[model samples]
Target: MVSRVELFALIRRDARVEGLSVRALADRHGVHRRTVRQALGSAVPPPRKTPARSSPVTGPLREAMDEILRADLDAPRKQRHTAHRIWERLVDEHDAEIAYRTVSKYVARRRPEILLEARNRAGVMDGFVPQTHLPGQDAEVDFAEVWVNVGGVDTKCFLFTLRMSFSGKAIHRVYSSQGQEAFFAGHVAAFTELGGVPAGEIRYDNLSSAVRRVCFGRSRVETEKWVLFKSAYGVTSFYCMPGKEGAHEKGGVEGEGGRFRRRWFVPVPKIADISGLAGINDRLAAADHAEDARHIDQRTATIGQDFALEAPLLAALPVDEFDIALTTTPRVDRYARITVRQALYSVPARLIGQTVRAKLDAEELVVLHGSAEVARHPRLTTKGGQHLVLDHYLEVLAGKPGALRGATALVHARQKGWFTATHDAFWAAARAKHGDQAGTRLLIEVLLLHRRMAHAHVIAGIRVTLEAGSVSPDVVAIEARKHAAAAGSTAGDVEVEPPGPQRSRSKVVSLPERRRDSDLPPDSRPAPSVAAYDQLLSNTPKKGNAS
Candidate 1:
């Protein structure tokens, strides 16, 4: 093959400069006359073309392989068939004698095309209409999973984000789970932070907390609680289509979740619990003002400026905030524990067989017996875990003092610093003096004193009693009362003395006179001086030297 430049040079030289005929140049160069004429006509060479070939093994099965791959588009992700599985199915079910690699190659090549065609048929496209939002008119809500280092333990946490579409402002909160209580609480917090509710509509996917049943298109059978919440706030809600088809509806919140995480939680916030997370969210909320540079309305104005314009358009807050707690009646078990959401919490042993109303929220579990709250526990995140308060079991332990030695409640108390080193020292001394059961009974009595006195007073009393080497419960009680009285006085507990009758004339009373050395008692008297006798001896002695 001759280069284009060389062909052009030869053609020009022979045809134009040397006056060579096209037939003469073609014969001399052993080339076709048409080629020489084309070269002479133009300097550019024609591109090479290759003939197409069909694979004997895979060509016949192309249609069947394509159908199999296309059917996978509707199958569950985990249940979808792989290329190797497809090959096995072809050999076993279809009696095709094709090699596995040939089928695999064809499936790999055609699977993406088949999936693309399926999406196209389903109306999933790249085309999106730019949205225009009115002030306080719309908001998008979504939850994203993020990794958090909580108390040195790495775990996945759900970040609930509500983004106002008009202002591009968002509220990001962290929760242990994406349960209904957390969902409701997130909304309450976001609304409170924004100072009002979005008036037009709040958009959400078919989250189970909101939608009890997803109907055709955007219609939904919403949960009863969700409906009540919507009514309470006087706001409307719009459900997006389920799954990937509806992601665009809440795209604002989805993007905000990512942006906020990258900007604030990039270091993977190290928090102890939900309260710590709340503190971080408060800081993030304040820092959001710095995002004023973010443009809204396609660079027409900044988000902060737009937000200022929209803040006034929001609906006034409701008279009262919603109580985002799940109320349930749970029977306390023999262990004096009630199971709420698979977590066990203790109540008084007397309520062991009773059913108590348990109000559970994101952070606390409050057990109420009729009108009175009997037990309160920090909500547990781990499933099947137990949170026991030693005080709740103290009454039962008093009866069975033997159980106090290695009880779970005792361990939990020690871990929580409720049972301090002073308590341990007192218990040890009591056990050494009395028998184990008797000593433990005494310790239980001391522990019961914590009900009346403050923990600090009880601890101080224990230290005082230990120093006095009196480990008796009576001594501890006395010391605790004295400490409590002192604390009360120091804390400004004042008592006014009654006013007495006015006496203008005062009585003159004299104090006892001071006694001389001679009038003092024998044991208290001072010794006489010997300085004069020593001076006489110095003048009379020195016998050896004076003689």
Candidate 2:
């Protein structure tokens, strides 16, 4: 393979310098005489390394992949994957039947594929060389596979990422599930990570993310939104003909993605919280931009070094980030709440029965009834769970007893075991003595103790007394000697018990009287219509009912 310019030069050198005929020039170059003549007249030099058919042998994997490809050959190229990429995607996305290496070997053995990458033109390889970068002129984008366990179910998810070819900077964001929105959002986020849009061009595999039509030699079939997107950023998009051994197209970001997954996303990555995981990702992307890599562009020292040169040419940031976040239409249900993956989020009474958008990210959920942001909460991933909050739905508990069980986003209160088993026992004992309202108040006290020590220690101390059937969180607090900042060790495994079982029996001492039903407040909003409470004698803590 020779560049057209090279072919022309071959003829030129032979015809004028070496006294060779045009036919002889074509013979030496393995090109037609006309091609040789055409190359001679071209003003632009021919591309280096004219691509060629890579396949040499075929086997079972080849046969299998061929059948899959053959079935969809005429439909479109973008819709059907090229051989090499299809190989990677099969194993990466679907856990296909064969190894990716096998798919790659088989595709390479076929020489020319009608899918995956574009076909190479013969003779272009004779004197071909790759193009040099021009500062902020080009960027490459790619996808990486990440494994995550959302709740108890383990599954693989795709991460969309972008790497500036000149600067080495990359930006990435996760998708709960990948489809068009996730793919589009990745592009938006990558640009944001780069601080602005690159002025040159961005390269991508004709991923379903960017293209819909896959015509041969017709490499320009692109989606409307993507066309508009690139046009807005003021950059050109180039495509390789499908079924070609043309790794050179998006090679920069392609290799970058693999390097990044191995260095930053792999080995062992654990996150108890989603936001923390995102923070680590952002840090890694920023680090890649600053560290110089082995390959250096012509003008700039390295990709990171070149980024400074290119930054000035990129598009300006918009007023708001593309809320690439997903939103779902749901109504806060009858219980004054909206349910997410089984965990319920309480919205206000005014929004009840009205449809709202549950704008969701990997870590948080925001409920909006149209334009107004009504409520926000951490999104849960499991089914059949309760994250009930008393304050968010306090309107439901007015004048009712035992109606409120959960503390509000009191995770803010720095409370330990706000609704754990020990809390349950203490509540039971308190209700036996002072009624559910008193039990709720006692629950608040244990949480407040967290200001002095870790919540677990507070709960451990609570259990020591509450487990013995006691209502005095204060007495329990005193017995545990947690009067001051606890001297307990910080080891996560430490065991601390709540106060004593020393009982006060026999001659009854006076205690504060419990409120009667008529004593219920009159000014609060009426609760959701429901069954009435058991209204009976409640003037004092019933010692007979005491635990």
Candidate 3:
């Protein structure tokens, strides 16, 4: 159809500019001559009339569909009657022989109107106003699940995020699991990195780590440790509503987790260990300072600038940091190992049959006997896992030499490079000479030397003994002492007297020292002779054989 303005312009152009008649204009523009006359008589074109059409399929079903849709006003939001449901009802309930598509078209057209009317009746609001946050007043904390390649294994890791509400500054750390220890450790680390805790309140969802039980509405039974943590930081805790309804309460961190993951962890970070992950976090924190262009309080200011302003307003850090380790008293088994979180860690053999306190942290398991820390191991994630230190079981292994050959502890020791090929070579030679049991026993004795001697010296001793073709424990000990003394002398840590006649020497070295029989290095004094003791014994009185 031609527009009114265009038709009027065309008629005027033909009549005045071209000097064409109304009939010619009508013929050229493909219109009736009377219509062309009307256009020439007045600038306005006549309105087009609507043609009446019959609706066979939807004509009868329109009212029924509208009624069904209108009835949805009282139904639950999720269970509201859909257009397809209306179509099914029309066929099944009303026996109407209309095409489903025809019903779909009519229902789709009318459903919006029905919903509008329903909304008007219900008096529901459609949107929320943007909220303004005060500096150092609030922060939000949340965890997001991300996949990270740890030690060549693709594992699910928890990315903990704490976002300041005012400046939008955030701290992100990844952990192997979202356990209570990791949760607490994340907060401690984030607070330390941020330099302070929010002075007013820290908002969180109903995380299991914080909330022990959810009561009606916003009431909660908080976990005792979480309460202590908040107290230690001198910050109050606020919980968002449950589920999706409460998501907006901690919206800052909720969005931060996604944004950070997309920006930094897009390709799934391949980290070698937790320390590597911590390094990544450090880099991310440094990069966050450069993101200063983001807006705060409707003004163009850097997040770093806002954070600087808010930093002084935050609460001071406590003098003592909260211990985020999970403490337990586990009894040391006969193997001198304590079970913690389904993983076995070895303590000193002397602690066997005693209950020692085990502090299980995010990355380490520390075993304490009374006040002293007896053992520490990298916290294991696998169930039924064992982390053993060969030194911890050396005494036991020495007593039972047969157990040393195929011991699981020995396997772990070899895997860690603590037990080297030198140790194996020494053990094999000793066993060849002294027989299996005695040779293995001798190897265990050499292993015990690690306690008093430096590891490098022990290794050197092993090499020296192996080269000398003697697998004697005493010989290894002598070699170890010699190596230790040589190293100390070379490093200028020990003084050796120059060789001279014993009578000419100004100082008299003790018998034990001169003979090197007191475990001192041979260089301390001249080697002693037993010939003098034999002569003295022979010269002594022999009453029965007196001549």
lDDT against the true structure, each candidate: 0.81, 0.61, 0.81
> What is the lDDT for 294 in model 2?
40
The number of clashing residue pairs in model 3 is 1
Model 1 per-residue lDDT tens digits across residues 1-547: 8776787678768787778898888877777888888788777777767778878777777788888887888888899989899898888877888988888788778888887887799887676798889998999999988887876788788888888988898777778789899899889888888889998989998899988988787789989998888888987998887777778777888788888778877888887654466676677677676676777445788877778899888998889778779999999899899999999999999998999999998767899999999998877888898889998998898889888878898898887779988998988999999978889888999998887767887787788888766787877766665666655432123232343454332222223322434675545557788876887876775657765
For candidate 2, report its TM-score.
0.50
Which ranking of candidates, highest lDDT first?
A: 1, 3, 2
Off by over 4 Å in 1: 1-61, 87-108, 119-125, 273-275, 287-300, 353-355, 381-383, 420-422, 452-457, 460-470, 473-547
Q: Each candidate's TM vs. the true structure?
A: 0.75, 0.50, 0.69
lDDT of 2 at 327: 65
Candidate 1 vs candidate 2: the lDDT winner is: 1
Candidate 3 Cα misplacement greater than 4 A, ranges: 1-128, 266-299, 473-547
Return whichever of 2 and 3 wins on lDDT: 3
What is the Cα-based lDDT of residue 101 in candidate 2?
Answer: 69
Model 2, runs deviating above 4 Å: 1-129, 148-155, 173-175, 179-185, 205-248, 293-300, 319-322, 326-329, 335-351, 361-363, 369-374, 377-418, 428-547
